[model samples]
Target: MYKIYKFDEIKNELVKLHEIDPNFIDDKNGDYFCIKDEDEIIGYALVKKIENNYLLERMFVKEGLRYKSNGTKILKFVVNHGRGKRINKIICNNKDIENFLKKYGFKECNGHLELDNIQCVNQRVTEGKKVVMSSIIQNIFLAILKITGGIFGSSRALISDGVNSLSDVGSSIAIYLGIYFSNQPADEEHPYGHEKIESIIGNMMGLFLLITAFELVKGSVMLLISGKFEATPSYITILWAAISMVVKFFMYRYKMRVGIETDNSALIADAKDSKSDVYSSGGVIIGILLSIWISPVFDIIVSIIVGILIFKEGVSIILETSNIILDKQDDEFIEKIENYIEKNTPVKNVHDVYMRKSGDKIFLSLHIRVPKDMTVYNAHNLADGIRESLILDFENIKDVMIHVDYLID
Candidate 1:
């Protein structure tokens, strides 16, 4: 397998290519593209911008590598890289490359082959952002309904659940903002992009929920100890609780699906939080029923229990997000990647395969040992192949950085 990249620095192995073939041009005026086979520079292509169009100055494949499809690979890579250019013109003496350029959509225009009228368009908004916005809207609606209903019906459990929903509005807002910022392109200050902001928001929401849960529980406990229970909750509270349960159930399913699909940690946490809301609403209904049939004290007891559940959820979120923030090594994920690299590539040994989660993406860095006699260019190409394959195979993998180590025999 071969990998292609934009060539910048003129390294020793690149110089070796000229030594191997005296005709090889080492022009630095235009953009140089190098195609590597197991780390050796086996082929190259050059493109230069003149006026408003791009000129395909030269394309070549090493003598022995020509008939093996290396030429086609280089042509495809170069064409894709110049897609948005207004006009792509080719100037090549090789008949094979000329045929390839034509087959790849370049047509004879006057004396040179040209591919013209390439169009560039803006990308659509991500699914993660859309889903998070939906969450924020739903939570806001639910918080308003539950708070209004609880206050009018005089149900402590319903009021506490309302506050839970209110807190969810805050959590959903955090998630929305996280997804928004994470989608921004990488800038100088944040080379890795703003993906980690999602994890940080997750942690902050957990802490917020923790504090909210404590206050709710404290309020319920004081009411119980003071022996000043409010009137039995009206039938309206039961209807409101039922409505909340139904809404939260659907919200949970929707968020979980989108979260898994987008691989967004904040969205997943928000989904689980929705699930907790359903359970709390169920408790609210039961407390309302028992208070009407048996005793109003059950209403206060249920609120305390609901508060405990919220606290438990808050702790869970904190632990999960903390692991992601601290770059906790996922042994299973690392093992799977290492196994794939060793089995599918010429890597002699895989080492230090580390990964960290940020928003919906995972960034991986690893070290792999290659043959001691392999040139640095060969090692670099081998690593590039492994990195490309890993990223293509794993959807969540956003980037991979590899270090080449010589196998000590």
Candidate 2:
């Protein structure tokens, strides 16, 4: 006979369970139960029945006491609970948990079960947020420095560069909001999930960049026409511009790494924006140097060129995001995906391999050919397997729809 600890009392104990299972992130709202031996809690399990499926979110036993019967008891208890709840499938992505479930008759499927139809936690989304937040914080400090240095040093070009940095802060804020709403688990209203908003975020960023470009262009033209395109050259202005170039180059590389890792288009756009910042800061530096040697008119001229370049980039980003929203097909990626599916899954034929991007998330639709004699359940499981395989292969893919057609004799 043993004692069972309630969720509230032993929930904190599960924090250390991450070491046992890295996928076992502790969520307070999840149903938690702990197996206790007298006053010491030896094991814990967490589950959530989302939509119509059950998610075995996390379970673990203490390292020292794992060889005992505590783990077995917890597994039996949760399995029984799942059965009682009419949950046909309980899914886990962790290899250890998956192997353990197999011993109890849970077979590996093509795709992991979506708990109650809710999407699983996306690690890339988490990483994306971290990258965006870091960009915002760093941009704030840099913008302040550039704006302060520009005003005091009377360098219009540097002030405009400072404004560009400020715009990046706004873009990052928009990206954070996009990532936030996009990750809200798929619901009845939107079975495909809420990530499509990222394309809109991309479009907004594009529009913002274009507007900033317009303002800079207009200001530079006015200064040039008025014959007042002169900046009182200050070492402080050049110093800040040099600092900005270094900072933005680092940010560009960091965000680019995050963008590639997450396969997130919005973050990639942010990375490109950071790259543009590097160019803008570089332009500021060159303008300051020229003003020192040649004429201050070069500063305004360089600002105008920078504005035109940013406008060109803005158009490019808008077109890119627009293509995503329009469901533009990429034949190259489609072929790659089909080949990947063939290599990884049991399915022999894949057709109509259509791919679309919604923000950082990818939506894939494909028809799969299966044996005519296969049972519906078997086919469904195969489809699930294929889906999981695809997700594992492509981290950006959010939703996959596999249409199973009977293999004609």
Q: What does the lDDT come to for candidate 1?
A: 0.79
- Show pairs that collide, candidate 2: 50-115, 50-116, 51-116, 110-384, 110-385, 111-384, 111-385
Clashing pairs in 1: 39-377, 39-378
Computed on alpha carbons, the lDDT of every model, listed in order, comes to: 0.79, 0.77
Off by over 4 Å in 1: 5-125
Model 2: residues with Cα > 4 Å off, grouped in runs = 1-122, 341-348, 370-385, 406-409
Provide the lDDT at 266 for model 1. 79
Best by lDDT: 1
